[model samples]
Target: MSRKVIVTCALTGAGDTTSRSEHVPVSPAQIAADAIAAARAGASVVHIHVRDIATGQGSRDVALYREVVRQVKESDVDPVINLTAGMGGDLFIDPSNPTVHLPGTDLVSGLERLAHVEELRPEICTIDCGSLNFGEGSQLYISTPDMLREGAARIRELGVKPEMEIFDTGNLWFANVMVEEGLIAPPPLYQLCMGIPYGAPADPGLLKVMVNMLPQGAEWTSFGIGRNQLPWVEHSVRLGGHVRVGLEDNLYLSKGVKATNAQLTERAISIVESMGHTVATPDEAREILKLDKVASA
Candidate 1:
């Protein structure tokens, strides 16, 4: 059966990719502009992560998030805004002294992480379901059961859909527990994040297992980082799921070729169309995800 895929553009992740690619947006205006461009290029949703304007690193500043959301809402194209509530969970431990928190650590309460989400009230926000080793460094992403519960409850209360981000099988398992515990409502939305270090490897077998583990009738999408970004688009579509692409997962359109968010969205659209599948509009995506219509500003 043919399907209409919802293409989500994850603009500028919190990673340190600014130096690697000039296309990564750092300021709120740049991020909003890129999101609008991606929307015009056929993206139904825009996953956002604000950066420190001065340092070009990730930030949890509520004002920065406010400005980005404001600009996106004021734009002509109305893609579903998905803000990242995954910040404030980084736990950088001191290598020599494990008990000593390092400089990169930015741990905070779950409520503090959702401050922007509460104030902005975007249609969608992400909740990283569980903790992981994160990456090659001594850094660890901390999302305990209590933290997930608090985040999920608050997101539910705000009437915003929680896009559960599953980094590994354990995260997926706890996400199911969140649903069973009645924190998340029906028609859950999930983003199967593959190819990250120390988590689920970006493999077809792993994707198949993760996809099967999703709640019945759930709306899901999958992505792979770096070289696997484009390939995973085809994999997701073939596996009866949606697709995500942007500078967040990859910096290059091809080897030695930098790519903008709009360029990535266009590429994803081309792939979907080539497979005899239509790309869903923002309104169509809202319908498919069962999200209430967000009024235009």
Candidate 2:
């Protein structure tokens, strides 16, 4: 049995989740408030993704990221702030032109994606390990080996812990390669993203297979989308891993009953405690993740 399980709340994802649930935080104020509440409710880490409030579309503007980080730090929230470096990797191809990227393709260099982590120095940030065919369309989430190497190196130099985001088995293998290449810090962190259509399925058998591939001495968490989110709270624990929950990956406590990010965290904490496991606080979580000591941000 796992002694201590850390809960990470993914506040607001960059997907089209804003309209799916009115409870999803849009403005920076709302996002910060939700994060603080989730921390108070027992989440030790908060993964964040900013949006254009007017249009609810994902954005990579540093100004928006700066405000979000500032608000979270200024507030009483002590959860580890994890900004998304996975933004700028979305590649919507143009079949018409074949060679040219479409309007939706938000292709940016690895350095450009880490601007927020470099400037704000969040305790943790995601370094998406590999690219894959996303959903049923022509959309592809491209994170090539070269980009992953550069992103991991930049994050390492900034003294930020990179939570290697692995969408599939291949991604996990490549993360190990980065570790060997001296691109990442020691004892690399991983987040096993399950059930995103084109990626690995949200099955216990598959999750175990992915978990088995984790490098020795790696810290990891696994999460499944939609209905699988709640089940993963227990699955990850039993598999010697941590847990993550929030509106970013799921919205309802029950169908037709929307849930706030704090509610989701509370529920996950309850499950952890029920299983004879204790949850870690932000400070404690930092130590477990081997993150830099909190600065006076």
Candidate 3:
């Protein structure tokens, strides 16, 4: 049987892309509006990251999250909401003095990071499974084992599916461990993130290996950054995993063509259909992922 692919549009990311792309949604209203558009364009899920309205930088403020969630839920189209709990884990150390933290540092306890999630009660939320060097700096994205267990447990307690964001093989390892330890519920959802700085490189061989390492019966999705975005959509579907796309991963739809969340989602749907697989609806996605139906507003 041909598989049903779930297309998740990462509406806005906590990156510096707002300045680079005119379509990146910065405000809560824009993010929610774009999410609805993506859903109408055939995305079953919408991954969200709220930004500071004044600066267009990633923010973990609960108020911003509340507004975004509110607007998305109130909209006519109902896509599965996947709020990111990956913020508040960034640690940027001073290059000269390693002991001193830099301005970009925003470390917080695990529960604190999920403040919005606990309140909003979205059907799904992301939990970075491990730490990484992050990018071209003294910066690190920390998610220790203890932190992962705590966050996973909290998400489960709230009856929310935790989408484990695996940046590398080691992160996948820990995610499997979380599943084994009963922190992550059955049919764990993993997001095999690729082409992000020093983490897992966007190679077919690496993705194959990562997919093989996943717990049996796990639901997985994959994406690559920049130019690799669309290619990875076909790659993930061919590999029997779902796909993610949007301005968050790539600013351009084609070379020099800036894209919006809706456009990216439409492109993903086209790729899935071209491969003879139907794109899953939000209801079908809920059934596939074994998530509870979201209540209407």
Off by over 4 Å in 2: 293-297
> Residue 6 lDDT in model 3?
92
| RMSD list, candidates in order | 2.0, 2.0, 2.0
**Number of backbone-clashing residue pairs for each candidate, in the order shown:** 0, 0, 0
Q: What is the lDDT of residue 265 in candidate 3?
A: 94
- Winning model by lDDT: 1
| Cα TM-score of candidate 1 | 0.97
Candidate 1 at residue 164, lDDT?
A: 95
Weakest ten-residue segment in model 1 by summed lDDT: 288-297
TM values, all candidates: 0.97, 0.96, 0.97
What TM-score would you give candidate 2 relative to the actual structure? Answer: 0.96
lDDT of 1 by residue, 1-297 (tens): 778899999999999999999999999999999999999999999999999999999999999999998999998999999999999999999889999998989999988999999899988999999999988879999999999998899888888899999999999999999988988866888999999998899998899999999888898999999999998999999999999999999998998899999999999999999999999999999899888732221
Q: What would the per-residue lDDT of candidate 3 be over residues 129-234, giving only the tens digit for each residue? A: 9999988979999899999898888888889999999999999988998899998776799999999988999998999999999878999999999999999999
- lDDT for 297 in candidate 1 is 14
